[model samples]
Target: MTEPRLRELAVADLAALAALEEAGQVQPWPAERFEAVLVSAQHAVLGLEDATGLIGHAVLARQPFDAELEAILVSPARRGEGLASRLLAAVISRACEWGAERLLLEVRAGNAPAIALYRRAGLEEDGRRRGYYPPLAGARREDALLMSRPLTEG
Candidate 1:
């Protein structure tokens, strides 16, 4: 596969983004929510496409001196590759360009793989939100772990 290309998302890309998001997430975001992100000025939406096509995506919502990662997904068919890590690098790069000093995100407490991935990318365990996520279709509710990383390197 060719190196994935990162591009800013447009309103028309919402459908494809929604599909990719749905495929990767246990609980997917609705189309309406995706549409909102695409049109929101305060958020940065990026699409990652390679020779095969839309491989992954990332979204960052800017705040005063920080930003929150709203979501990041790599297609189920493309997981375990470096696609997610590539998307994460792009998010960190974009966040720095947007003048954000720090970036943070929340992940389901039980998601060990995701937590490990973020830590590898330099995000440290910062805090936790108790019972933050509603249970999956029939699963029990899970807490959310907040992770943060500085945009600048040492």
Candidate 2:
């Protein structure tokens, strides 16, 4: 298999991104939503792909001072392959290049794998929102843990 290359995602990639989101997330955003963000001026979408196809992606909403990591996912079958880590690091680099001083993200509290990934990337838990994530199917609603990492080391 070829090594995945990271690149700025385009509007054309939304359908594949939607499929990856659906396979990797409990509640995936509609493809149109990604298109809106990709077309917006203050947001960015990044993706990683190999010879096969898109295997991971990150969506970010940015301002001059900070950015919100709206979503990030690696293909379900590709999880544990360190793809998330690489994609996250790439996003952090891109965010700083875009003049963001910090990057923030919220993840389901019970998502240990995802939480660990953020922690490994130097994002510390800074806040929480009670019952932020709606219940999935019959599962109970879950809290969201807010995490952040400063773009400039200080």
Q: Which candidate is the best by lDDT?
A: 2
Task: For candidate 1, write residues 22-97 as lDDT tens digits.
Answer: 7788888999998998899999898888777677888889999998999988888878988788888888988898
Per-residue C-alpha lDDT of model 2 across residues 45-141, encoded as one tens digit per residue: 9899998899999988987689889989999889999999998888888788888899999999999999999999999999999999899888998
Cα error of candidate 1 at position 71, Å: 0.1
Q: All candidates' lDDT scores?
A: 0.87, 0.90
User: Global CA lDDT of candidate 2, please?
Assistant: 0.90
Quote the positional error of residue 5 for candidate 2 in Å.
1.0
Model 2 residue 16 lDDT score: 87
Model 2 clashing residue pairs (backbone): none
Question: What are the TM-scores, per candidate, against the unseen true structure?
Answer: 0.93, 0.95
In terms of lDDT, the poorest run of 10 residues in model 1 is: 1-10
Identify the runs in model 1 with alpha carbons over 4 angstroms from their true place.
Answer: none
Runs with alpha carbons beyond 4 Å of true place in candidate 2? none
